[model samples]
Target: MKTIERRSTCPINYSVEIFGDKWMLLLLRDLMFNGKNSFLEFKASDEKISSAVLTEKLNTLLNEGIVTKITSPKNASKFLYMLTEKGIELVPFMVEFLNWGSRYNPNGGPKTLLEKIEKNKKKAIAELQDNLRSQRHSYTNNPSDAF
Candidate 1:
């Protein structure tokens, strides 16, 4: 019998450490799908994350370099959060989750998105990245569009 050792400290384990929590993925999902980018927006999610939990997750994501907060020019007191490249790179993981859920759960979610993902996995991921890049550029050039 042979025993296997982790390769380079387990990349999946490291990611899971940062985002394996119940709501962390949901937070990422909202950012990826619904374009949510603020404390208030995340709080207003249909899943109804509590304020404390949301705060903790947001802080954790920030500390992990997956997200960054920029002060809103229109409102000095408010901040707009966005995914870093590291974060946006998780699209495949999210897509896989959606595909798995669509297969196993099959109760909710946009069947159209799921079908697109299923039918054209590569194109779907590419479109997601392109959209994120466009959104980032738009938000930076026109901060008001951050909403």
Candidate 2:
């Protein structure tokens, strides 16, 4: 694990330390929603991430245990990346992020869905988390069960 300085000891400060960047969120977005697993697919994102930066961010997530890398069974030379339980737990945060950006950015996609979520934020978040749990095979236990 990497050690670093903190601006303060607040939980928000820790969040900023871990994910307060354009690249991390975008990379995570691809994995969470787009179902992108390969390096080439992530590189092909609309954000146009540079290869070197992508490599660095992937490594960071790996180090944090937020993502796992598996050797492709079909192709020895390829690797697949997927979110771990920790990463999947960020769905609600991402939804809020979507809500905020959609409110300010006219070109944001899924306008209707965002409006529905905006009206019923709690319900939307719960539904999304449940959806993610169902989709992830590794989730032997429901995450919501923990809370």
Whole-model lDDT values for every prediction: 0.82, 0.77
Pick by lDDT: which candidate is best? Answer: 1
- Model 1, runs deviating above 4 Å: 1-8, 144-147
Location of the lowest summed lDDT over 10 successive residues in candidate 2: 138-147
Model 1: per-residue Cα lDDT over 45-130, one tens digit each = 98999999998888888888777888876788988778888888999999998888778874857777877887899999889978
Q: lDDT score of model 2?
A: 0.77
Candidate 2: misplaced stretches above 4 Å?
1-8, 112-120, 138-147
Which TM-score value belongs to model 2? 0.77
TM-score list, all predictions: 0.86, 0.77
Worst 10 residues of 1 by lDDT: 1-10
Best by TM-score: 1
Tens-place lDDT per residue, model 2, 96-142, is: 78878877897885866677697898888777666655545443344
